[model samples]
Target chain A: MKKSDIIKLLILIIAVSLNVKTMKSMHANQAEINPDRAKISGKPVASFHKFWADVKWMMFIQHMGSIDLTTESNSKDLYQEAKDILDLDPGFYKVYELSALMLSAKTPDLAIDLLKRGQETHQNKNDWRLYSMAGNIRHQETFFNKKVNKREKLREAIGFYRLALKKPGVMPVLEKTYIKTRAQEAHEANNDVPLVIAELLEWDKYVNTKMAGSEYGMEGEGGDMFLSLEENTKKDILSLIQRVKREHQNNLAGKKTSKAMLASLFKGIHTCNSCYNEYGAGHKFCTDCSKPVKVYGICPNSQCRKTHSNGKFCEHCGTNVKPKKKKK
Target chain B: MDETFAIASSLWKRLLGVRVVYFLTICAVSLIAITNMYDILMIGESRALMVDTGMMLTTIAAMLTVISLAFDIPKELQSGIASVLLAKPLGRTHYLMGKLIGVSWVGIFITSLISIGFVVIYSMSHGAPPAGLVKALFLIVISVIPMASIVLFFSSFLNEAVAATISTVFIWVGYSLASLNGVTLFDLSLFSMGAEAFYNYEIPPSYLLKGVVSALLTAISIVCVTSFIFNKRDLQ
Candidate 1:
């Protein structure tokens, strides 16, 4: 045979061998029907049964895993199996996102790990939607952690809000706005009016200087600052401030209303400050009076309905009161 | 035109074919719709209902392609009627095109009617079809073009039974695998890895791959028809 024919024969052989190898590799990658694995894991080996079970477990995890972690929910097993199912079929990207979201409520660290795994496995691919979900989980974590520190809580809330805003997918602005307003309320409910007013002024200043050239214009430019305030119960804050100011003015006027309102305002402020110490942060004002109140001692005055701010005198009525000792 | 219509009517009468094909198509589609209903009830979740319907349509389309092409060509050849048919005003290409069109129309019509029935049942049980169902159905129909072309190509080359059955299964597997690859899966097991590599790395985008596959099948079908026209001597 000629040199050309020999080369052609060799090339054909190589081509056929490669094709056979490719075909073998294709079939070899499928999950084997391992009875032991199935028995231990309690997962079905059959494709249809496995697919059905995986989906069922995915739904179960979603519902149960979302409950408070402090509650003794039977979600641990569901979450574990859901992870296994994901490991079993990594192609099911929806399962990964759902599992992460669910797991975050119980074990935020595990949720973050799962999300990282998902990102690593399915990056810059069809499953990029999972990244946005992972970001949301991170945002929830930051929100939870913010409740730990009083002074840093607002800053942390802002960090979380900014992180969520930076994510690519279009999150509903209303939802974020609700979260931000709640954070602001929680902050105000903890601190005194001067602090809140200071924070608002600082935010206004930051917007003017830092966000001037950007899309987020000055306070009134895009109504960014005013929009945040719109959802807030301005009447509650305004009334509290007006009461405090009237008391201060009455202190100069030498009137009894000035003395009474000053004592009430001081008690209300003390209650809020004490509550922040107890509850950490994110406490709401009273549903009845819209005043920042705390659960401490009982009402001291016979006629007065409101509780005292851990004092011997009635802050509202100036009636000398007794501190009730605990029975235990 | 009258003569052509008369001949077409006569051909239909001579074949006694319409009823069997119609019955088979209905049975195929009904079986699919029933299975789909079972699937929906069993799953008990709101999924894209069109997915199951599309799968059934795919199977029906494949069956129609194989059965129609395999029988039509060999039956023409075996009866020594090819010469008589070619002797008429119609060319071999036109005859082949007409057969394909008629068979495809019958297949599509039956499948579509069954699909409508399935949709009605689904709506009654659930609600109106979701946003993407129509688009998905269009994709399934587009997929059948390649399936039919492949069957026609195989019919020209091979004997009826082997050609029809093999090509039917082959087309079903090929299309299913091709579409499955579009979805990402992360099982690093040998089987999944192989599938992923084949789908993600080896194959181009599904639309492009389907276009190429369909074009190739059409080209082969045309070649087969041309061969039949040139090679087969008249057995008068």
Candidate 2:
């Protein structure tokens, strides 16, 4: 062999060694950047870890597409798929979310566990959707399974929402959810309608403001699905607001409510003092109870008849307002 | 270096003109149609499934192009084509380097074409392909560098069939091999962005820069080793 070739071989050996060292350090750096690297276990077929995860995810979605979720049982296969997907790619946020939601129907504990795993391994620590879903699941579990403590589950769900609210870029729906759940807890413990209504109104105002600011915000549906929260969160809040308003209106009207309180709460609607039934304009009595109700807000002057304020005179026209005598 | 580049350019043009290249491109585009039809079946995950399938298909095509070098090199040597070229001013190292660049170019070309198809299909159905997907495709193209060099290195000593098999296996099992024994050499999974692309997460520019640099370094090192081996082998 030529002496030049011998020197070249020596240099090659040195170069390859140095290259190997550099690669090792590079691998270390990569590991540092990806801390959740430990989630992937077992020898993957063909090292297509991400590819196989995709295939698994496709299968999952395909199965989901095929089955009617209402009829389908929470089988062990679902849990296995969740484990397989999470194991294959811990960074798969959608897999965590959609699968956990599916699992939460019957296996809520597993769903919460999966969500917790997602929170730990997800790159974005500030992600609120996972926490929100976990809270939704937890809150739901209390209703279906009587075995669990209702108060404890409610507290945990509220805690999850609280944590979610602290994170940046949290959706307004979370705050609304937190309020609604807290109201539920309050109402369950004490049957306090006013306190729940007040909390619901606060959340409703916040969500409505957010909705007003965005072009995509949906106005609420009426009380068709009173059992379930609506898909459009703004709609859900609006629906809740309307429901609570009715409950509060009834509660306030049933009591010895001041005229100012009735005016502020009902806003242009008149209610019977005796029966708490609503009355139309020009009606001297409640239609339901036939009880005499003095419509005091109308101007007494025949020349300038208009709705008047609680003051002695009409605000729309300078005419004296008087309490008319009720019919015997 | 000029001769090497000239050889590379010619080989690139020649490979692009091949009938198989056209067939592969057609296959890749049609595969997109098949996945598009899978939209109803994938439920909410249609976009993700399409992206993953597209990336996997692109990787397979690029790897095939790279593996074809094994056959090309050995066939040239057996047919006295390499001898005729070596009889001139062309050095064996230059020849190998040219083949590496040329084959890698072909792989990259095919990958780019398929990527365009993927992006277009994805946009039509899913509004727009995410930025991360484009980055993933770019990384796959960059990874073909090391892959081409590995095939070249193996073909320098081993028979065409053995070289092709080993190269294919090495790339296929890259993630497992890396995790199994910390073997970073020839680990192709580093360039895989299948998950990131599917999730539509942003990939930092620094990561891409690192990938490009790493691919170049791996390619150069393997090429150096290949040249050394090829220099000692008797042409006859």
* Maximum-DockQ candidate: 2
Residue-by-residue lDDT tens digits, candidate 2, B145-234: 888988999888888899999988877776465556567665666677667666656677777776777788777778777888899899
Q: What are the clashing pairs of model 2?
A: none
Q: Which stretches of candidate 2 lie over 4 Å from their true place?
A: A1-47, A61-74, A91-94, A121-129, A164-302, A308-328, B175-185
User: Where does model 2 sit among the CAPRI classes?
Assistant: acceptable
Point out the worst 10-residue segment of candidate 2 chain B by lDDT. B174-183
The whole-model lDDT of each prediction reads 0.45, 0.72
Q: What DockQ does candidate 1 have relative to the true complex?
A: 0.07
Tens-digit lDDT track for model 1 on A105-184?
76655665666566555322324345445545555655676654433434443443443333343243523343444445
Cα lDDT tens digits for candidate 2, A19-113: 56656665665565565655676664544666677778788876766767533354456767878987877887778888887778777888888
Against the native chain B, each candidate's TM-score is 0.63, 0.95
RMSD, every candidate, angstroms? 16.3, 8.1
TM for every model, in the order presented, reads 0.46, 0.73
Q: Would you give me the overall lDDT of model 2?
A: 0.72
